[model samples]
Target: MDGDAWRPDLTSPVGFVESDSEGDLEPSDLESDVESVGTSVISGPPADVLEADPAIIVAVGDSAISAVAATDLDVPVVPVGDVPGLSAVDPDHVSNALESAFSGDGRVRAHPVLVVETPGGGRERAVFDVTLVTAEPAQISEYGLSRRDESIAQFRADGVVAATPAGSHGYAEAIDGPLVSAAVEAIVVVPIAPFVTRTCRWVLPNDGVVLSVERDEDPVVLCVDDRTVERIPAGEQVSIAADGALSTVVVPESADGRD
Candidate 1:
């Protein structure tokens, strides 16, 4: 979809039809990104999805290891806005995205954990400091649900989650989340301190836009794998687009370059 990958077949009588239809169906139209929960990856994802190319993308203000993990796996990650050939379906801008991100060459700050207290006779109070790696709450308007404003207005807004199978396990156990298999292609939407209980912790549909974290509090604590990386804050608001996308590269035993 990034490059000029198609052309009219000059020899076929039905040449123009496929080309004409393709111009209408672009990569930009993809809004939903699904999650596959686990520590070990599936040999091959199911036949349903049109797999995304393994990318090296940096979430601005994300942890340093965010980039580190991508690099170690030899995935060519740039920041969310860095890749030049990105589809319009991608909300983050790609134009100035690269240079702006490269400036953050070092320092991949980690997320913090908060100790929230339920204020007596008041809404729960969560005190946190914003750093580079954590989540916050945002409005529903940001996700193109404005047309359904009547329905959305009833709900309070929220943030994104970087859930792994291990993390999902903890969240589910702590917040009454559904017991989704670590091997399943799933991520839970356990709404943090939600206004309504019914709308909480939905096993997200495969084709969903898991809403981005908000920037309400100056900082929010991200619950990373059972440990607290204190004083982390929320950055750009974006959906929980878990890159469940994996590849089957041969894992060579350690020594040197043996490919």
Candidate 2:
């Protein structure tokens, strides 16, 4: 096992996508990502998972590609190849990364995945770095929330975000969400394109934080990860919490490669 990759249960690949070429990622340009396990299971795109059981995903593409792929598949990915946001990863060392990851060799970092329930009585979960809730009308909208049953925030804006620490560095940070230590058990909540200048982002503990789009007649969408096609209609209270830990990859200290 390599010294740099963390280890988690790898009994089955919830989903795995690979690209033979480099540069930018286009899932349609690559071969099918799904693998055939047996007569009971078959391989396909992320939308195929609605009929399949939930499983961990290994996305073999750049960060942007991997993020969308993983989000669609509804699982976390062991990013392979050239991923942008996942800096310092050696494309050549991917094999070593797999070995260390499956063998349980590197440091363990846990990321909380978000669980969303719809007003239509449908439930879906996302292990994305960030989940964005925006207005369906494509205009400014009203936002509401409560933490542990206590009213904390309510405002009008384009949308709001609930991101895991792993996501804090990306969209969360771009929206001015504070980047907290990934090691900490916390969730960052930020108002997206808020109407009020005083609106701010909050780094709350990952326990009982609930956020919702308070509009019912006017619809909104919950964009998981970044799969616009997989958007969920957000007219109901969507519960956000630490449903489970997403196993994050790290280039082991022992493996000689990029950071």
Candidate 3:
């Protein structure tokens, strides 16, 4: 997605969602700052702010932006705190960031969302990545990767992670997975502690990517981002694909020099 595709309109009201841990920065104080710019402010929790349908949302922390991203809302978000893969501004720069966003001086980057499905019609959406790992520590298991019914690779490993391009910079990168560009419509698949000394990692298309537990010596669990969703029985298949993208405002002053 091009950075200039979307820009906030300062003429309309904007929403504000802040983290609870921001001790000195009260909601009213932030609201006052936003109002200082002569723009109407819609101040409340993420859900409430979304309900009002503000022109844009300003999330104040990692947790705050994560909450907004978890929702199915498609509105553009202006991250105001520490958010990975985003050009997020400091809390003190909220006013400047808002001006940049509304004045069309900021760039908008789209982060793809992953849709994960399991047997018996279970489905979930992930903003970052989805992982399938052994429930027990250090337990080896055989897993298979496939796309469009064609086998990609089968190997014995502790687990596997399928991360979005934005998510590739985190856990996946730490495990030797390639860091994918946000503009690339691909998923990064990396084996976790493979039994073999030499293993292969993949950057595959987002659609029709499947991971199955070929041989589960121990139980396995599925994780969407940070939270464990449920245990996966042996032989069950987990499917993942790119669904929609999250639009984020990227201000030049806040960018950490990452693509």
Candidate 4:
């Protein structure tokens, strides 16, 4: 019940006869009706809000590029959930996507990192020189932040969160990073266990925009899944985004020449 959504208790009116009033009144049942009639109000681009707009544009790289925009226009995101005629499909914005994809220098050197408190409250200095090989940080680096996930992990820095649809099921979901429905249309970006992490996870960046985290405090640190690399020491920078990469899927629908 924090940000995006919440559950509420429903109540109904009831009638009763007072002992002084010589009348027999039928008492109304409120419990069962409340339980049966209540409905969850799915947050973000509610079906009704999306009904007003017609275009639901989602770019490649699993970024919710058009999600908020479409929602703002009252257009339903492609597959925020299932719709009778809705189907999961590839994003139409590919030219730019391909440009970003190929632009991958097989390297990213952007954002400047900063130091913060150590998880154990020690003066342990840590850094990260993460290389987005086949492994990850590929997408996160797309933002070209100064020294984002590209750095290795260290004590001061707990870890870098290279979030995606595949990894989002866990903590990402908890942070309200958009849920990946059965259909593939959105991606959730979440940073886990960041020593100086923000109170809440930020939204995934589009292929064009950049996500830069400022080091407001003295020192900061990010360990890679808890492993220390010591590259992103205090006062460094970082970058993130989807590298020019494609994860092919073999859905039966695609074989049928459809989504």
Candidate 5:
């Protein structure tokens, strides 16, 4: 990941709402604050936001930020609520964060997005990770990993996860995966529960990596970020690569200082 100083025009800001009932903050209250700062607020769905093409996007919560990341839009995102991976200001400080961003006091960090291609010609983007796992619980399946036409390893496990640096801190870290720096362009690959006592986890290059379901007694599914996209049968291949990046705003005081 790379970062540059970015100061967005706050004259027109878009508010992307996922859920307003989480904390004490409400959508109406946020709109009033935006107006108080002499900025126009446009609130709608992701598609509407894309169409509106506002100067900056204000994500209200974790899911809103995830939704903005999933859109793959090349816009600067200022997270206002509790968002993971990147630093976010509290609900009470939304107006201050926007003011700082408008005054060139924020840095724009580019977070890599994972592009997952299925065998059926379908493609999806994930800001965090892509997972392949058995459809049923505690079911072991055979999976093969490779990169640039070279074989890496084959193992039996409940599932396998390929996570980006931003995602490496979440589920991947819980499974003892390495914490990759945001400055490094790498993918953290880890097996969920390997049959062998000691299995290997890899931090591979971000491109040209392929995962195939070698053998499966049960059905398997492919997940992009949070939701299951489709079922992947045996003998099919799934390719992942770092296609583009998401621009996220990191305010001065809200910086978590974590890679």
Candidate 6:
């Protein structure tokens, strides 16, 4: 399946009648009638977006490289994460990845980071590369913005995820978002458990898209790289922009079959 594939057909519909708890869940008695669902593997972004410039891409923690791009010195090592976005499968692979990045021409791939401003006058940031804006129970969520007085897409769903190409392989992919190529120059916005049957995921241009969320109910949470979590209180709003860049380490061409 393509990375951007949407499956609203597998989602349950919203009912008009309100219930006490969480309200209006699909009737449990209709479970058997809904039919069992199947799964499909979504591929990553298209090949054309991958720019091969024979550059050395290093995988470093955000703390080490967040303020500036590390292009002056050689990156000796990289810490790997078990999570798909930052995971480096094995020791040999890690070594090869570093070697490939080091031996290649001196250049790096850049992935955008999110700059989040909270209602409390506080701010947070993320690189390497997605920020999940969602609510619990996977249902009570809606996100939208009226830019320059024009209302953009008002996404109503259980959750909304905005991920960059480098981070697309992680939570974004797990939530059925497209696996954007790390080299792609776009951001993927996917709705988790959408109520609308024909809801479409957005592959927005990365010219600094801002997502604003506001409501009168409970606060919606923001998770940055699954590490930092913030809540935007009722009536207040939080804005997320595709800002900054995260440089990554690349796997070498010579280590093709080591896995």
Q: Candidate 1 or 4, higher TM-score?
A: 1
> What are the models' TM-scores?
0.31, 0.65, 0.88, 0.27, 0.92, 0.57
lDDT of each: 0.27, 0.54, 0.80, 0.27, 0.80, 0.45
Off by over 4 Å in 4: 1-162, 174-176, 180-187, 191-198, 208-230, 251-259
Q: Which stretches of candidate 5 lie over 4 Å from their true place?
A: 19-24, 80-82, 255-257
Q: Which scores better on TM-score, 4 or 5? A: 5
lDDT of 1 by residue, 145-206 (tens): 11111222123434323343323444334555555443444445454444454764455432
- Candidate 6 accuracy as TM-score: 0.57
Error of 4 at 121 (Å): 30
RMSD (Cα, Å) for all candidates, in order, is: 19.9, 6.8, 2.4, 21.5, 2.0, 18.8
Instruction: Provide the lowest-lDDT 10-residue window in model 4.
Output: 125-134
User: Across residues 161-198, which tens digit of lDDT does each residue of candidate 5 receive?
Assistant: 99989888878888888888778999999998988999
Q: List ranges where model 1 is wrong by over 4 Å.
A: 1-154, 157-162, 205-208, 213-236, 244-259
Clash count, one per candidate: 19, 6, 0, 58, 0, 4
The C-alpha local distance difference test score for the whole of candidate 2 amounts to 0.54
- Minimum summed lDDT over a 10-residue window in model 6 is located at 40-49
**Model 4 lDDT per residue over 1-259, tens place:** 0022111122221111112221221112222322244321122222333343322222121223222321223222222111111222233222232222223311111111112233234221111112111122322221123223442223222223443333344334554454443233223344434444443443343222122333323323343322343334333343333332221222212111112
Candidates ranked by TM-score: 5, 3, 2, 6, 1, 4
